[model samples]
Target chain A: MTAVVPPAPPARLCPSLAAVYRAQLSRARGARIPLLFVATFQSIGIMVLMRGVVDGGDGDEARAVVAGSAVLVVAFVALNLLAQYFGQLRATGGLDHYATLPVPAAAVALGTAAAYASFTVPGVVVTAVCGALLYQLPMGGLWVLLAVVPLAGAALAGLGAALGLLAPRPELATLCGQLGMSAALLLGVLPEARLPEPVRWLRDLLPSTYGVDALATALEPGPDWGSVAADLAVCAGVGVAALALATWAYRRAALR
Target chain B: MASSIARPWPGLAAPEHTPDGTASAPAAFTVRGLTKTYPARRLKRSRTAAEPAAPASDRITLDVARGEIFGLLGPNGAGKTTLVKQLTGLLRPDSGAITLLGHDLVRHPRRAARLLAYLGQESTALDELTVALAAETTARLRGLDAGAARRERDAVIEELGLGPIASRPLKRLSGGERRLACVAAALTGSRPVLVLDEPTAGMDPVARRAVWAAVDRRRALDGTTVVLVTHNVIEAETVLDRVAVLDAGRVIACDTPDGLKALVGTEVRLDLVWRGEPPLAVREIAALRHLAAVAGRRWTLRLPPDRARAVVAAVTQGPAFAALDDFTLATPSLEDVYLALGGRGEGLVRS
Candidate 1:
């Protein structure tokens, strides 16, 4: 007869970062995939509508439209969704689960942001490819989009997380996320020459605009890698700072 | 009656010592001068504005011995949840020190976290994940490897009889099912100390028994220390090695279940059924506090232990002795002690 045995002892501390990232990724697999598809389809639809209006535009105009449309996908999946997710989590008392765990607050915040941002990659790539094809722009430096998606996602997702954490109600959080996405749309999709000087400065302030600038520059026929690198650097710096702020917000929300 | 206390309470004096006079086991948790205050959200306008707001948890202190199942009993809004949250490191205390498993909770909360598993009163966290995933994920987060997490999850699911809804999302389950799933997640981990807050609140009898059985298994097998915060004091009394009664943010009393029960020493209850023609002498017995004489057939009475013999003789010594049926003499229970100390018994309050 076989004797029953107790299971082996498990680790006392929270799992490693890879485990947390894996868990978050798996959790978002079902909920995020459909949202990514919607984002991709929305960006492609915008490009199709703008095609007739920008049919006989300069290369700069074409680059702006394509880059703006592509980055909009990142705004939708990374910024908008992440803000709403964290807001709902806080409102519903879901943060207590992580707070009680042995994991660091940074892991919970960073892992969630990274997972949500990662989902935007597919939509960003699809929109970039489709937008360039429709606008008749050069795709020579399009490989630069690989860096643009995550860096921009980090910047936007971080803001969304902070907004969500600070919002008193989940509904308010959703509104903030929508406003952020709309700002991305208005500032990012339009060619810079069409905007007034003041509004152009506002566009420069938007984090996604830097992402748009990088991707748009990469699409130029004689792309200046130096300028693109600078734009990407700004995006990276903003992403890191925004994520740090989001993590701080997470700690504050937990205390509350 | 005044000398009935077996020993000076741990709060009034040092903790009760074992026969060897050495402290039994190392304390699983030690809380001292733990105080937390929040701004009075519903302050009465008539009060003097200069008065300080009341603390949510007053200067509370206690020690829970290792391998002991300790029950934390209190009424609603008695700072029970607040205190447990502080113990689990989810809430910070305004002023105090907490040491859990020998690690200072405030200074090294991560280290303390590794030693404790908490089941909160609410189950919102489980709603997003499937029952199996929720249990498995919590197990993983507690430091279980992939294979061990799955094994523990499966074991807990089977123990809790959650197989039917194991694959379903927690949001879709009934409230009791969700509670059972939460219990499964909490108990599946091997953390040395477990704090469960109102775990049986929504469970059915079968599920409640399952939860208690699992906790009992953990205690018996690994000598795991458990801190159970519960409203179901009657059920909790069966397994509790020691209990602390909290009222208005302070620990009023802490003792073994028997010790608590013994506070109202030998207070017996007599239940009787009367037939037709209720005897005047039995009905007029001064010591008997009559319950209900339904249809002149059933009757229950509560009285002091010293009056029991006199009342029993009064009923049986008369012609109505044969009329009495289903007579039962009962000793006092934990509920009696709870009502006498933690609740409305104002005279039993300790400083």
Candidate 2:
């Protein structure tokens, strides 16, 4: 037998968040492309359908239609798909892989959420631009999406992650993800004025509604930048709270 | 119950004991009074439990010497997995002390990865990752820098002969290939201890041999301590330095393989296949009266080695030979030790 030469043990406590993020990003890219396309096309298709009923491109109705569709892309990939991802990981005993690692529970959850949220970017941008052109809305104010995409994506992705981790079964997680996206669609995409009084109260509770509202106000002529900032501020606050909730959910599930 | 457990193990030492002249040596791992119970859940009205749920892991204790390759062998629901899970810090024991390398694991479960790496029995987390990436990622997760991670990944790929499918995702590989990749991935880092559950579960004979070769080399060169959970008794006999036979969440016996088999003591195993239902006259043979039914149309028995020839002759050439289909005569194995310990074939789990 050869003399023993043990491999040196690791000195660091856990893997860096960036390292985990990069790895998760690469792992998800191939599987999520088709779904990313579905999100983009679904938003564009919805916008096209609404174009027939709403005539004036400069009206509030058109702005609501365009902005709501754009944010819907974020809901699909970040909210729906991220839920499915984590739920499936839980069901397949995949959590064992992470639980055994020295990595913190936060790194695993946030890193995965960030990767799934990143997939929504291209889809969100395309829908926003296509909606702008289809509605003949002013393109100058469309830049608010820089703020809208991340805030909305963060908010939805966090909720998706929490739902997946908290759900007792993978099927229940999928159902929750679907239900959340449907709420985003009906409550976020519809004009607030058109909703029932009680339903509008629910619209206020959803984080994505603030994103839709911010984008809608920005698409108008001489828009009130104050309202957009307030909406976005609420979004940023909700994002922090939601992400914190997600981190808690990850710890609970990992321990279980 | 035809059990030899009453005879006691010939030689079983605690982890604190040294085999050499030294009297006191630190153990690599130690477990004392480990127990975990599952809570009874609400069931359908038609299926109420007749009794409270049994503890998944009953009070158990063992010690693993430094650099030892220990094996846990048993039938289904033997608590092997639950025990391993607690050791890896994946499952929390209800109460016990799990000491690994001087750290109190029960109180500081997160520190488990400090000295141990665990490979679970089933997982799909790495299915999306390529073979090289799986190893590279695990290395990175263990706190290796990107450059060192790559070097470690490359070394493992070469060691495991995974160059052909280095870029292939685990899901794209065959069952054996996927299992091999998972092993390579889980064992990539320099952790001192490894907890492998059924490491060669889906492997072919050649792949199985390759896996053991790698594990054996690690033990020989790195002096790594390994705790393996497996049902493959043949592999356990050849590779494990020590074996623990568990039944119903408890260790019935623990000793060196040779020491445990010695308890069988000169007994020869006889496996017989039936030509048809034996004549009543043939069935009355004293040896056939105590047959342990193995499976459909086959039975096995153990007797004194000297009597094996007479029993063989009676079943193969005498008037009873007309009723016998086939027979195999062999020496006792570690599995015989398990059965001789009163194991009644998958009777542990309260299904």
Candidate 3:
């Protein structure tokens, strides 16, 4: 006689990260229209201001121009953080509603991180193109440029998610974002030579520092793969660790 | 004479049993010794300071049967939502067991997730998404294919009478419509168990009826078990097969609607409007044993299940009772049952 086994229970259904990514993309696209308009006009204005100063410069002058544009990119990123976090706080409801879904806390955190990353795409592209046009730097490695930009944006987005999770309320999140942006801009974008040793060391620890460094290396006449790889690794590590913390914090809050 | 006839039904043959040998039919869900305690701050006013904190949500247990619409009746701060959260896996219990479809809740939450759908008190749908999109998203989250997701969304929309406004963004919908959209999202996958917390709040009579009809259809067509947390006793009377009345995080009473009403031991008041003054013989006829009290132009009779018909016959046939202008009988309703089970004052406010 043969024995019959009962069938296994049906598998649980969980939404894929791609679906969460898509939902975030749709939301970001809606919120980015005005931000894009402002970034376009701002990029054009910066390009016009830089055209005369570069004046078909030599390699040394070109290096200086690229460095200056990196500073501009860092500043632009800071502005992006300010606008994105404040707008999200004012426009969307708090994350309390998402906690009720059967989705894991990590998925919710990843969704918001992906949304912030998507919002940065237009600004980063415009800044890169404007920097190349104004400084007459090499732009042949388009694929590499694409890869580096997203990694940097992911790092920044993860930091934003961590901040959003830690802040007591939406208003507090906006305030903290503004303060952090101010500190980063002060240390990194201001003339580096004038900063003291301790301040310079602190700036190096910021994720924005690595992002600005990678952008400069990407636009240089000769590609610096070593520096690029180092920056990308550091940024990626920060992003993963911060995102993991945010996920854990969110889970603790929801479960409590 | 009537009292003698009312004492034999309990001795009759019992109902047939199932193959499993349990006295009652097997229930779809059974919970034992469930407990959830949340740390809450204790606020105290003194000369200098406030006190610290304490634990809430003491131990509680419940059982629900197949196709039974059970109400978890409670007032504010009664831990009804906390229990619902634990049952849906949003929060873990401090201790105890919950078995649904024979699967342990804590050890096998993922398996339990497939069979249960929870509609939380908040309308959790995205405001920017259209009603159809919201329903389709939830269906997809429940792992339905694209085609199946659309079909299920359409079916739920139609069932909830949301077809007319299906394409409208959730932000544009009225409060009731928004609540219905949330319910539609929860119901799209057609899971076998539904945990609804005040689903009918903010709904008009028409919308409320539509929600009840959808629940009825789900139960009848699929034998789905529904656990409803509602305070609307009037509407609940028509739909609930049984109820668990809760007070201060405790289950005060759990029973079939008829059984709970029986616990109240309420009597039917027969108001006999006799013309002028009636004869003393009629008063004597109303004074039968087991009848609690007889007053002016009214006889309050405690009619047990067996004595109801005989009592009515004797009152109508007695000669002195011939001058009656009108007579009416009032039995215990669900509201009375609710009040009898210690749910009174502010607790009786219908949702």
Candidate 4:
């Protein structure tokens, strides 16, 4: 007689998350390579262009420019690409697959976000290092990116996922993603001192701004560790809230 | 095992779900009073009725036995897919109770996911993965260990004859091949219930046989319960142990194929394929035109068995035989049952 082992119960959150992460990582590795390259080069190109207008390594404008450009790489992949990814996923009925699985909704959303975020590591690191050299900023505190990349990636990926899942149509989701990346560029890449009060207030609302602020604070010869921690904490909070919203959006889309 | 529900409809045996209900044993699934309506939406804002959209599933109730193949046969827009989705816990009903394998599915959709393996009608999921990987991942996702997952994946791939395309991405496969890959994935884990919505939609006859054979193997070996949603009346007649025919979002008839067919009485249908237009016999035309439905080169006529024999002999042995390419006199089919039950054949294509 053939042995018929019954199916086990639905996987718990951790194992499900790990399985989803591995699958997404393997699937996206090849597809996202060229895009990650573009993201990295785009950040470098912006930093070089800003180098013409804003002249030196030791100034506050230089710090903002380098930091903002570095975090912009994270925004490109985690927010823009991830948004398009989820939008296409929802449009193509991909969410139905996850909804049918025994995995938790959080696992599906978080695993995808983590996979897209993973692509940004090389881009963010390379951009930070190259921007430091081009803008003549101190590279001493560049270690701050170890914290900044994930925090910002999480916050932005969650927002991207939410936009894709909540949008009624895939084209609208793509538009939302582009608008989001543009906001990151205008608010994050520009020096805070040069912005109008209202626009600066808008800058405070963008999740990547906290990442840029934390990185800029770390670029000083002697970094303000307390300010950096506070900024990192806010990014972490936004990341969590946004991810939760994404999970909710996923449920809404899947259940429909 | 058997199950029952309270609400009673004509043309079906009283469903037994509770103490007051009629089922005698344990059932794999019990759905009661399931109703879902899509709310009306206005893209441009107009004064429309405050009424909701037509109900997609209107008070569907059924009990699927533990190991039998139960088919959901319907015309398009008959709410078959909606009912299937509700049964699989992918869509929630506005009001009703669904109990699958002793779990309250409406209350716990995640548990439903664990207990059921579903192959949707049209899926682009797992399009990034190769056929082998899609099957393997599904096994793993269903909580199989690595060894078992791999074993099941290999078994399903070979069973489906997908070895040639196993390495290719689902996105790169033909529509039928992609659907086959999805079937392979859905069959990996030995879940108690399998919900297949048009599993053989894009498949050729050979592939359709493979898909059904794989499902039959699961049913025989593992005693799996299958809830199939299909518009293929022929397949439904040949394979379904029991079937529910739906029209306009309601179950028009539910019974064993024979039981439903019995509703059509002793009538038989004669189908004729003509090499050219039907013969221009005025007498034959006057006698049969009102009862027969003629569409170009094909003609269908329903009558008593004795009259069917006479008509068959008349068509085959006479001058009319010269115009006939083929002819079949068959007993009432599930489609005939639907027709007898007041279905207009709007969405149920008779293959």
Candidate 5:
């Protein structure tokens, strides 16, 4: 009995990172519009409320309110939404679907993080524009935001993904995401001068706070370029570190 | 056991033959002493109740010959899924070795990834993506290029009759449609080996037949190896070259369907559809020692091969023979083999 051998498909190699990224991006197509709207309007409302309190205040206070509101956009979608997505994916056996594929675990984790981070861009841009107008801050150095959104989004999104993977239940993961977003709001949206000495350490630890500081420094008249670059560098470093940690966490959850 | 097919399953296209040699074909998978243990979990409602850690698969050893459709038959919690997961490299085995093609599955898992296309028990990854895109993306992930992936996606979708809902989101599709989409995605990329877990779980008879036909077509056309894990024993029997019946984490029987059926004995089953109660003379036949009720209208009498002539003579002479609408005598089927080997006769049964 002869075993007939059919013509084989063209041999291809490992999973393409770009393909995985595209697939992951497509997953959010349905929620993209509503999510972006929520992130934008929510950040704008926070800015509007902060604007009233900082009315007729010094430029430093104005910079804090505007920068904080802008970074809040990243917090809303990247941190909050991403956590819930991963949490649901885990609880629903979605990881098994990816695990059976030829794709590397890191690609799955990073692709998801990149997709969630990309979703934050429109919100971040809109919030930055509205916050600057509300605070009457100069938009001269607004170009710095081009670097700020992704870096802050990556850092927050990675953390959110990690939390979702590590949590034992989906509900707990959602709670962790909400708590993380709340921390971002309290630390990122408030001026550092008003924070206590001990609580200031937490502000330093919150990745989005550096994003706010960077944007605020850039808005200053005759801004300190060195400080802005330093803050941006820290944001970039944290983004890389958080993403690596998230990839590690993904491997842990999937293999477990 | 190594012989040409006298006749392939219905609807299967004949395979092209190469006559150089057929006796020395390779084995697709060689798994030896594989085992997996899940940690014990404390009972949620009663903390005092603690269950011991159990081995899901205990020292499983099997060989799947190349170009064969092999079935892994078992009921729920029978360790079929765990064993398949280990074979496909999704879960690490606690011990022993799995050699796929030539590479060690535990040591060189990347090789298995290239050769095996797996359909998981659940379709959760691409639930939000359109069915067509899901199929195409999975093909892409399996290393098919853009054009090839699209072609494969289209061909598989058409073959499985998924054209009507190809553009619909998987979440919007019916359970059977979603299952067909998952099967289509799994069959893409022209991999040498396919591992499907419960591919026909929620499918109707038509869909189930379509899936079986597709699997048979693959084996006939490409000499591709298939490892089918399912509880649909009767339908699975039609295509299975060989099967391993697993129960409580162990393989209790392994053989071709006919060979397994022969294990019970050379018994011809006499089925009669009667309009009234059986005659006293018919029940007095010695072969009726183990008479079984099939349905309201039918009754079965299992007779040993040697006693067939006497039983036939006795039944034809009985007064109840006039009330019988129809009667058939046949060898035992795979369902009988399943029942004689401890399978629960609760689901689909064939007479």
Candidate 6:
């Protein structure tokens, strides 16, 4: 009898990173409702504290406080990043399932990064509203700054992906997240002119520095377009590099 | 006297066939000198801690035919999973080529993945996702539209008998149900080739039978090719068109179940029950050329398929051993074929 040969399989149209991000957004919004509530409350609390402290200060001093508060919001962004990474990894075993699919590993990483960015939407809105009302910050070019928010988030999400890939486990990822937020707070949130040269140089490497600087530029009375441009460049550059590294790391791990 | 003879079943011998009647099946999957080596770091005794790593897999080669349920049977850490991982595109081979469904698996993984579906030993589904959702997600990931994915998921859930628990979260299901979910997810896209790693490992008998029945149905209905990595011989024998027994990262025996069993030939054990003592001249009676060996009260006689009645006639004619209580003629089973092929320890049985 003649042998029966099986036919080839059809080509696959992979689900985009946007889809993965949407799924992650839905999951995070579902599981961490309490966390989101606390972060919103904390954003309001920080705005109130800034309002109380800025009453007797000069305009420049109030500007610094508003900028520093924007930097402090990095802590919330960092927490969201950690939560998204851990949540995805906990669902699928360390991105291996996504890696094995017909889609590119870069797409999976990008999709996950997009999802991470999506999770920070609530924090960005709350922080923006709080900063406007309590700090009396100038709101010109606020729409441009709002557009930059998701871009900054994308950069941070890429960084989180790199950390998730490099760290041995989820707990280590949490520790790294803590260290990252503390460093960002020290460098970006605090008045940079008051900090030492080495600390400033260290802060220069952080994506949060660009995020805080961009928000400050947009909210300043004159709306510094040059500073916004520079921050956007830095954020996009760091995001691309982190995403490449994360894709490389994920490929190595999955193909092992 | 029975021990004096070596060649039994001489009557059933047939002339070997020429090559014209025996056409070899073409290989659907071919692995040529495949090797996957993982690094093993060795610690140094010097004050400066330093070590070098080594590779894990040596060169291995295998071929599987179309429509064959090839079993890659091996114990834990025998590199079966590693080999399967390489085939499924989950891991890249260090060297060598693997062609599946007319495409090189490594060079054109997407093409290969289109034809192949892998059900890993560990379930690959989000715990919080419902069974239907998980299956639908897999179908969607495989490029099925939402409507098609829903229809396919429903069909698979029904096939797996998981309709009752389709809406429950996977973590809430029992272990068997979870495994069935993985199976349903693997079968979601209706890929022609399936690579299942211990698919029935933790299943009950009913579940196992159900899975086998499904496999049989798939093979008969769609001519789907299957590669089953299992140590469960009895279950595997039920549906396996052929078996490939793997040991130490190499295939030891590859053949049809009956073909392998035929290697042991036919041996009949005659249990005699005389008034008191067993026959004395029974040894002389067994000394006929048809007998292979006689041990204690039991006599193991090999009878050619055609002369089996003659041997029975000779044994029954004996006045010295007229009262033969019970006699059983036995042929080698798949398990016997496995053991005889040098599968030892706990290797032949599933855990």
lDDT of 2 by residue, A95-163 (tens): 888888877677777777777778888888899889989989888888899999889888998999999
Error of 2 at B52 (Å): 2.3
Query: Which candidate, 1 or 3, has the higher TM-score?
Result: 1
lDDT of 5 by residue, B1-351 (tens): 424233342323443322333223455677778888887787778957676777889888887766778888877778899999888887888898887765578885545667788888778778888899999988887778889889999999999988999988898888988998999999988777899988887788878878888987887776678898977767666878888887767777888887898887887777877777655455554346457656776777677866766666666755766666778888887666766788653453341
Better of 1 and 3 by DockQ: 1
> How are the candidates ranked when ordered by DockQ, highest leading?
2, 4, 5, 1, 6, 3
- What are the per-residue Cα lDDT tens digits for candidate 6 across A83-127? 346444733464545545555667666766666566566666666
Write down the lDDT that model 5 would get: 0.78
* Predictions' DockQ, in order: 0.21, 0.40, 0.09, 0.34, 0.30, 0.15
Residue B113, candidate 1: Cα error in Å is 0.8
Select the stronger candidate by lDDT from 3 and 6. Answer: 6
lDDT, candidate 4, A89-199, per-residue tens: 888777777788887788889988888788889988999898888877788999999999999999999999999899889999999999999999889989999999999
Error of 1 at B106 (Å): 3.7
A-chain TM-score of every model: 0.92, 0.93, 0.76, 0.96, 0.91, 0.83
B58: Cα error in model 1, Å = 2.0
Q: Clashing pairs in model 6?
A: A17-A111, B37-B56, B38-B56
The superposed Cα distance between candidate 6 and the true structure at residue B193, in angstroms, equals: 1.0
Report the candidate with higher lDDT, 2 versus 3: 2
Each model's Cα RMSD: 7.9, 5.8, 10.1, 5.3, 6.2, 10.6
The most accurate candidate by DockQ is: 2
CAPRI band of model 1? Answer: incorrect
Score chain B of each candidate by TM-score. 0.77, 0.88, 0.71, 0.88, 0.77, 0.70
Top-scoring candidate (lDDT): 4
lDDT of 1 by residue, B117-208 (tens): 88987776567678898898887777777898899999999998999999887777888889899989888667768899888776788998
Candidate 1 TM-score restricted to chain A: 0.92
Model 3: CAPRI class: incorrect
Kindly state the number of residue pairs that clash in model 1.
0
Off by over 4 Å in 5: A1-15, A56-58, B1-25, B42-51, B266-333, B344-351
Number of the top candidate by TM-score? 2
Candidate 2 lDDT, tens digit per residue, B1-351? 111112211122333443342212345677888999877776777565746678888888887766778899888788889999899888889998887766678987877876688888765878888898888988888778889889989988888788999998888899889998988887777677889998988788877877888887776666667899988888888888888888888898888888899988889888877777654476445446656556776778788976778778777766677877888998878788888888756432111
